[model samples]
Target: MNNTLKVSKYLFRDFKNALLIFYGIILAIAVLMAALFLNVISQESGNASFGGFGFSAFIFLFVSGLNCFKANFKFLQANNISRKRFYYANIITLLSISAFMALIDASMTKVLKLIMPYEDIVEQLYKNDLFFSSFIWSFALFTLAASAGWCITMLYYKCDKLMKTIISFAPVLLVILLVMLNNVTEGALGISIIKSLTVVLGFTNNNPYTAALSFLVATAGVLGLCYLLIRRIAIKD
Candidate 1:
């Protein structure tokens, strides 16, 4: 109980800092997206509602998790906390931040719908095939991205000189790989993987249970990998 509280406090402190920075970034992005939406509504005579905007919020959350890991790992090490505590703290912090960001995004979307003049814009946004599919995929992508960030941060945590370089470049490399693969392969790989996984899990798109199961599986896998990496690489000073 004491250990949990300690980890929670540490996690909370890190999250406090993250919340401020994340709020600014998300607000700015939201305003920009809103502007783009307005422009689209003006030019195309169609609703500007989009799924990419929501996915961008998730990406920002993942980046914030990376920042928290980089910051908290050093603090924990300096304060003589065990690596186990540090690992748990990181996971707790990441999950908490992700949940908070998700809530903020949902609320923002609702607010936009309420305040904007467009009728049924949100519904139309979800009706689009690309955006609708992305709603299912974004949760998994967000978890994976967060885990990848944690892995990269773990690699750089103990190395002062390489930390900034790795943090800045790793996400870019990952994004580039994903984009190139999607474009060149025509999503064959992605489709195959998703289909296989769905078959293995006995899931179909029509069932909400299937969606929840898929999301849980993806989150568990990412966090499991994150745990292993942290266990292996986290150093005690």
Candidate 2:
């Protein structure tokens, strides 16, 4: 447990500069977009909506997750840190980071909305959710994105060239297979999948809490797969 704490501390320390850099870029983008929107608002009559800012946060964390494992894993292994400790540290670090970012983003969104007609995709979809629920939803989404990236990275790390190729094409193959299945079932499969997603995502009921729960569940499933792949992964130079 002490080793895990040390490792988690190291991970958090290592992420500090990267996090600053990431938010710096986001700040610049937000400034530019706000300026552009302000100019447009000057010429317009009513409220103008700005979106896609929240998505940048997700992309940053997802890409961070994709790159987080290899170098750190190599360094920790060289220093005799066990894989279990490393993984635990990552879980701790990711959860903390996700929560922190989510809080920042939720606050930013509230501030932006107050200053301008800013609405994130979630706000547009969920429509009038409470601040706490929005924060939870954002946290769940950020964690899910990071976990997915980690899972994909671990899979690529564990696979050989041929398996990597297959994995690379797996999404396309899955889409093709889904299309065939849908056609065979005369769109019933697609409809059923969409309906299921709508229910699980709370679109039918317009509940962010349900969607947050689904995202958390999906994140857990992805992380579980990541652990399975990471446990016996062969280190590559």
Candidate 3:
């Protein structure tokens, strides 16, 4: 078998149980939430809505990306796998898992909407209920999350102790700085950024395909950075 294929198979096997356990937990949560909703609806006079479950999957995948690299890299390295092949396998695994989870999320959205007032992120953002559009949007968003997570872990892996600390606080500090700047500008910067994002995401036109394409481009750029970092990364204790 090809080295890349071998690595990919190993990754798939490693994640299989994690994925199943995750969905099992999600299923339990959904069941519990559904029952809660039932009781609430019975008591309430108006309609109730529940949503954002898709975001849970996104968060799960991002954390998965963060945790995937270190141990896997160490194991693969011990087995004499090339870093190039390891990286390739990771890319394939991330994409595959993202798409798989997206499909599940999209289907669940439809099913839940039928049973209750469940609105997914795609529906909230694009205001469209088309299954195909929902799936595409979910796929794009999940892939982006996974890729971004992978890039962050790769950076953490390549950095020293001080650099890791700095990287850890960097996001919070950047947010604070951005907020201060936006306040100084009387929210002009925030508004402008939102406008730009809305345009890039095709919100004004309700075009999810455009947003999906933008997300994919962003993912590609993130993965490209990961490649540069991964190539230089040495196995660490």
Best by lDDT: 3
1-237: candidate 1 lDDT, tens digit per residue: 677568767778755866687678767866776687776664676544443445676677667556767567667777877777777766666666655555555456556665443322223333322333333444444555566667666656645667668767887998889778977899986788688876644354333335435666777876776677676565555
lDDT of each: 0.60, 0.86, 0.89
| Number of the candidate with higher TM-score, 1 or 3 | 3
Question: RMSD of each candidate?
Answer: 6.5, 1.6, 1.8
Cα lDDT, model 2, residue 26: 78
lDDT of 2 by residue, 72-134 (tens): 889898998988888888999889999998888888888777666878767888885467877
Q: Choose the strongest candidate by TM-score.
A: 2
Those runs of model 3 whose alpha carbons end farther than 4 Å from true positions after fitting are 38-46, 183-186
> What is candidate 2's local distance difference test score?
0.86
Candidate 2 local lDDT, residue 234: 72
For each candidate in turn, the TM-score is 0.62, 0.94, 0.92
Q: Candidate 3 lDDT, tens digit per residue, 72-155?
A: 999999999988999899989999999999999999988887767889988888889899998898899899998898889889
Ordering by lDDT: 3, 2, 1
Question: How far off is model 1, as Cα RMSD?
Answer: 6.5
- lDDT: the better of candidates 1 and 3: 3
- The runs of at least 3 residues in candidate 2 whose Cα sits more than 4 Å from the true structure, single-residue gaps closed, are none
Q: Which scores higher on TM-score, 1 or 2? A: 2
Task: For candidate 3, report its TM-score.
Answer: 0.92
